[model samples]
Target: MYKLKTKETDNSVIEFIESVDSPKKREDAYQLLDIFTETTGYKAKMWGPSIIGFGAYHYKYDSGHEGDAPLVGFSPRKAKISLYFATGDTERENLLKDFGKHTTGKACVYINKVADIHTDVLQALINQSIRFLKETYPNH
Candidate 1:
């Protein structure tokens, strides 16, 4: 059974964000956390060392590789933040068209700052990404 992950004293994720040494980045981290929760309807939790993750899902590919992963997450990189979605495609081209100049790597979307992109569009992308994953791997 899944249980809510309550606050912890040793939250490496929060600590990492606080250690960024940049007020803008720190503020961005909090904004991302709020946006992620509001968009996904899933509470956020720290995953591993420096990821803010929302919800969870189990996956089993046809190749037999399988594991559980946070339904959605992001890492506050030094130069930019990376949002992790399950996939990417031309379908999101319209949104990306005005994503304020960013790069995409496989399943991750890299952005310099939250202000650089449209918040509503970002939320839309996150929501769409989650829905895609759930539909693609319903068992998860």
Candidate 2:
């Protein structure tokens, strides 16, 4: 069986943010904490060592792999802040078109700073991710 490395922990989100090496990134992390909390209406939790996540859902794949994951999350990394959102939502792509300066991978949107992107679009992404997860994993 495969193990999920990014499981949620009892670790403190504020302590993690305070440990960020860059002062600017630390400040951006705090701002994001507020945004995600207000938008999701859930308190942030630590996912693994770095990710600050809000809300959660359990997913079981067709191959029988199952795990719990945050509905939306972010990590203030060394190069850029990686924003996590639903992986397969078409609406996510449409919103990203107007999301300002950012780059996307399979599950993360990387941005240089909070000021570089629109918070309204960020909130929309967070909400859409939560809705998609709830619909996809109704039992969770």
Candidate 3:
């Protein structure tokens, strides 16, 4: 069985943010917490040790893999902050064109800090991600 390392836990999101070693990352963590909460209209929860996630949806793949994941989330990492958004959404890509000072992977966007990007664009990405996931996993 493949274990999902990032499964949701009963950890405290505030405690995690306060424990961040870097002062700047800690500040960014707080900033992200507010942004994600207001944007998604959900309280933040700890997903794994580091990720602060809001809202959730269950998904089942064609290969029979199934799990629940946050609709949007982020982790303030040592090198860069990882922003988790919906994969395979054209609107997400389009918004990133003007997102400012960020890099993207399969489903995560990396940013150095909160001030490096536009919050309005980030809010749009958050909204789009939630919409896409809800539509894709309607039962969830």
lDDT agreement of model 1 with the native: 0.77
The count of backbone overlaps in candidate 2 is 0
Model 1, span 6-110: residue lDDT tens: 222236666777887779988999899889989898877777666788877877768676667787888887888988777644557667777675898877889
Q: Please list all clashing residue pairs in model 3, or write none if there are none.
A: none
Off by over 4 Å in 3: none
Instruction: Identify the leading candidate in terms of lDDT.
Output: 2
Clashing pairs in 2: none
Ranking by TM-score: 2, 3, 1
lDDT of 3 by residue, 1-140 (tens): 98778888999999999998999999999999999999999999999998999999999999998999899999999999999998987898899998999988877999999999999999999999999999999997
Question: Residue 67 in model 2: shift from native, Å?
Answer: 0.5
For all candidates in order, the CA lDDT equals: 0.77, 0.95, 0.93
Candidate 1 to truth, TM: 0.83
Q: What is the lDDT of residue 52 in candidate 3?
A: 90
Tell how far residue 4 is off in model 1, in angstroms: 22
Model 2, 9-68: lDDT tens per residue? 999999999999999999999999999999999999999999999988999999999999
C-alpha TM-score for every candidate: 0.83, 0.98, 0.98
